[model samples]
Target: MDGSQGRKTRQVVAAIAAGGKVGRQKDLLACGHSEWSLRQAVKAGMIMRIAPGYYALPDADPLDLHLARHQARKTCFSKAAELGLWILNPVPQPHVAAAHGRPVPGCKVHRVKGGQTLMDILRQCVGCGSELEALAVLESAVVLKQCTVHELRTAFSRRGDGAARAVIAMIDPQSQSIVETAARYLLKKVGYNVQGQASVWGVGHLDLLVEGILGVELDGEKYHNTPEGWAEDLRRDNLLVINGVWKLRIPAAVVLYNPDLMLLWVERALDRIETASPR
Candidate 1:
């Protein structure tokens, strides 16, 4: 490619990369690339025409190409998962947001304007999923500092967002992971006063403190499988016992999948603590 042609190619490449490695023909044209330049670039294998109006790098993500073809962007659970949020259940198909376009086959479509924000995704999540699922995503965003509780509450304060606002009220940013959020939500729903990341004198922060006595620690194997992690947890458990705090250590999976069993255990432990203490 000559100097002028090379500059044009670089411009097109930069445009596509800027658009998450996928650009529409009109977008490239708006970026000062002519039809002749685009055609030449495609012919020279500089960029691939994934769809009629879409141009992407040859190795662009298939999902991006698919979304580009349908003029949609990820939203709801799909976008939540993409943003590394805590997703309790995985959807079978991608969920996308689009204002006006033919629905992408095998994908959930949420009618939303172009250039949707993280708040938009959260609003869509609240509208689309169950309360628990929505809470998980919201808590994930808050804990990650992606958004704030105030921002969310304000965003959902509009008319017709009563349900979304209700879900936003349930967000606990202190719940570190999805498992902790689920456990806390379940406990709260059953009328337990659940406190997340409650600090004890010696134990620092417990995953949850129910009724001010029972320390429920949700342990994911990823963090506890190592010998050092196991020893540290044991040390914390010992400190809790010394401080008159009863500890209930449950696997993260139990909180996610077998919540009933976890609840039963909690009830039983609380009962034991109550029975043993002189009321």
Candidate 2:
């Protein structure tokens, strides 16, 4: 092999690796590598053919390779979840935006331009998932300060009246976790007056207050798994009970995995409270 040809191959690999470990036949051609060089690189196991026009390094990210193979870009909940924004459901299929309309076997195509903005993704996401699921991602984005409320409101304002607008009206940047968002959603769905992050005179702030009487606390492992944390929680629970506020602390796993059971418990508690209260 000529030393210059070998150097060119290495340079191409480095370039592709830097650019998300994927490239195309046209990319190699633009980088001054001949068709013969691409064939040699594939034959030598330097890269793998992702599709007719795309190639990826051997150690490329699986999701990136999948995107390149289908000539699509991740969008909606898919992009939001990947960016560490909260989402309720694990995406059943890869949500992709592509110029072509041909159905890809395992992906949900948005059938548009590939480069979608965060606002664009949010607009699509609200229509794609359940109301709660959509709010979870939207509220998470706001709470994390990924997108400001003003920015989201401005985006929705351009789209006019629809589910996206309804979801925008429901956006609460106060929700700290998907569990909390789900909890608040479930309570409101059942006709309870749910206040998120409600504060007590001595208690600072609680996760939720339902019907102005019941306190619902969402406990995640990171904050509640320690003995000191456990003791402090018990103290808080005792204090709430003393102040005529009954408390129910829901574990994060229970809220996330068995939400219906938690909701059932909540409804039953609400029913009992209503039964006991004077009309």
Candidate 3:
């Protein structure tokens, strides 16, 4: 191929990869690539024929390849994870959506077609996972600005979606991470009115505020492992103490793994705070 032909072929390959790094034969043809060109490109190792009608870049993602081979789209927790959403409990196998309940080996398939929208994935998540899991995914979407809470609520307004709609109502966009979301949910479930991303006079924004008094800081290791992070946190703790605000700094793992213990600690703190209050 000459320089011009090579550039055109590269453009074609880029177009194919743009659509999830895979394209159908008809899609390639639609992009103005002739059959001969496709054959030449395949032979030249630019793209690979993964399935009979599916073509993909030579180094496409394995999940995308699997989805193309099965004629399916990722759904449920799998799709949420793909979209960089928070998942409380990730499943072992891939979760997918296919038309007419077609079975894909080693995958948990949802009976649906064209699972391309975020709403479809959220609905599948609600159907396949627990309520808490659904809430985490929805909040993640909100935090990422992928979709708005109103849009999600509107999508789930149809019949038989009361549960899903309720979960959507619980979404707090200010909950920065999955750990914060889980901790807030647990506190709320136990009848604590938790405010997310609450600001203090001297300490800026906290991860959560319980009953407008106790400031809860959910510490993920990624943010607090560095020396600078440790110094900043200590400074914030000193400020909170000086400001007469009761505070709790709970690690992300403690909230995820031993939530009951976390709740016990909070209860004890609150008890002490109440006892020492000036009447």
Candidate 4:
């Protein structure tokens, strides 16, 4: 390529690195990459042409590629999960904010915040997700220090009572994981006195303690996969039992996928613990 073309290509690359997306006529022109230079970069495999006017880096995230190709911005459930915030349900489709007519299938569509602000994305999440789901995202965000409880409360105040109020009232920044957050939500929703990250004398920290009687463990797959971890978990459970803390270990999958069944098991365990208690 010529020196001029090289300079333009460098400009294009900088733009992509800054915004993760490059638009042909718009961004290329703004970034000093002419149509020919854009073509040269594409031909040289320096960048990928996603849609008619959009370009992505060769190694861009597939989801972002899809977003650029579809001319949409990720928001709500999609953004929350992508940001590593806790959410109760798995996103069935990427939630996107787009111009009124542009809709991506297998993704929820919102007409608000087509190119969103951080607050706009979070507020949209509060509006889009269910009460429990919203709470999970908010709690995770606060715990991760991405957003503060005061910021969330302010955002909720702007939106008025309903989902935001519901979420803010129950948000727990101390909850460890999405699974742990979901378990707490479930137990709370069912009117159980659930305390998260409760310390037990012999077993370290229980995932949750319900009514100060039943100990609950929410085991993630990664932690329980190895033999050493499995044995350690067994040892912990045995110690808890020996200490007379009636406990139930629930898998993360059951917590995420089959919360009702998990709850039923908890209720049954509680019943057994209650009955077995000295009168």
Candidate 5:
């Protein structure tokens, strides 16, 4: 292939490999495209933005997703340099953050030397790059068997940046179902605070709780679909309501696809609960 064509091929390859998740920027640079080229590709719809500087080609096959993830990783490094936050996810760091030019004051922001950043994280990590390290830390914690949402909540003080809040908002507790996860994120997205797998006095483990009003149930096939499961679900649900708990049981499918309808349902539940409690 010609030089220009060969370069285009590499850029495309990187985006595919990222699984719409992560990638390498130096490879794109090696392909003869500058950072601007990657940005242009995103603007031109040649690829989708995964994070701040990362891009993805979509999920079609190995060839497609692989390149996407690879390209996203490169952007992670570039974004790290631009934002001055070192990423510690995707891979571990050798040195400290203060060594890499990160600001160190009351808190030491250890720069992991750019392995994963938000802009280079999952192919749709929108928001500022400043919290990219935090995202990496969170993702890594999960992979390393460190509970993500809990870790972020504890041992965590905001870094006095807007991006920190965004990352925290986007992070959700470990969910058993993507539908339930999406439901919680969307609910939070719309301004309704929610907690996952919460324990209610009567219901034991609920799929989701909107602070105090709404109850969303992700109907996992093993638990909520079978006849025996259904019988028990009814039992628990009845107990919740009879005990003066105002709630609505939403299926996993509705939570994932028809979220607007779910939100509407949430509004009604909230009104009912608010009227009952008045607090």
Candidate 6:
């Protein structure tokens, strides 16, 4: 590939992997080729046209990710590359990834600066959180930490692709479990009564609720990845029913990407309750 094209391809890739940088010199050096080749591909449209030598996958949505990450210069001291660092080296400042080019001056580039609110967490995170977490607060702001899952979910849908996904992961139906906690500050503005986690004889504590009516559960998918976990979820569901709490399980994927499905499911569940009542 020619120099310009190759550069664009490299840039696109760097863009998609936000907060992640791809080294042109290292990549081409390993392949016995020059970084200039990445530029060639960019011109040919063989790869995404990023800043210079960076490349995002052709199909990767540039709009979904922050295009600016490709503009930052890379630093070798990043914690992930360290041989034996423990505690995950608390997220890098702004958690911004470096790009190949003249550094943009006066830009405060910190890795994972603010992406998440403190509420997503059931409790304070142990050790530290991921760059994605810090980004939550950055993208949404401290006020988002105040809204209910329903309110936040609405706000999250308007974000671009990757950012939208990131925002939703921070809050899920589990908003029900912690709704009251949020309502103490934010939900009250919407005039909704927030309920805290409710424990049943057989079921564990549910995430959050409203007027003791709707139940919401946020699923991170860690449990579904294993067979034992899948079985446990089924068992848990049965226990939930025994305790008279019907929950809407919101998966991280649906919550982040296809959140409307979650809203639909919640609506349907609520409809069932309304239908049973003699109004």
> If scored against the real structure, what TM-score would every candidate get?
0.91, 0.78, 0.93, 0.82, 0.46, 0.37
Q: Which of 1 and 4 is ahead in lDDT?
A: 1
Which structure among the candidates has the greatest TM-score?
3
lDDT per residue for candidate 1 within 127-197, as digits (tens), equals 78899999999889999999899998888888999988888888876778889999999999999999999
The residue-by-residue lDDT of candidate 6 on 37-90, one tens digit each, is: 555655666555454544555565433133343454312122222212112123
lDDT of 4 at 119: 70
lDDT of 2 at 250: 87
> TM-score order of candidates, best first?
3, 1, 4, 2, 5, 6
Assess candidate 5 and give its lDDT: 0.54
All models: lDDT? 0.88, 0.82, 0.88, 0.80, 0.54, 0.45
Clashes of each: 0, 0, 0, 1, 35, 55
Residue 128 CA displacement from its true place in model 6, Å? 21
Question: By TM-score, how accurate is candidate 3?
Answer: 0.93
- Residue 103 C-alpha lDDT in model 1: 80
lDDT, candidate 3, 1-279, per-residue tens = 888777767876887878778887877787787777777678778999898878899788888898889887677899899889999987999998888588898898888854368888888889888889999999899999999998998899899999998898899978889999999999999999999999887789989999888989999889899999999999999999999999999999899999999999899988988999999
On a 0 to 1 TM-score scale, where does candidate 1 land against the true structure?
0.91
**Considering summed lDDT, which 10 consecutive residues are worst modelled in model 3?**
108-117
Model 4, TM vs. native:
0.82
lDDT of candidate 5 over 1-279, digit per residue (tens): 567755665566565454333344564565566776666655656666654444555444443243333321223333333333324332332222222454433232333444443422322222323344455434443534544555554434446434554566665445555466566767877788888788877668887889666776777566777889989888888988887666677776676557789899888878877788756
* CA lDDT for candidate 2: 0.82
Candidate 2 vs candidate 5, lDDT winner: 2
Candidate 3 overall lDDT versus native: 0.88
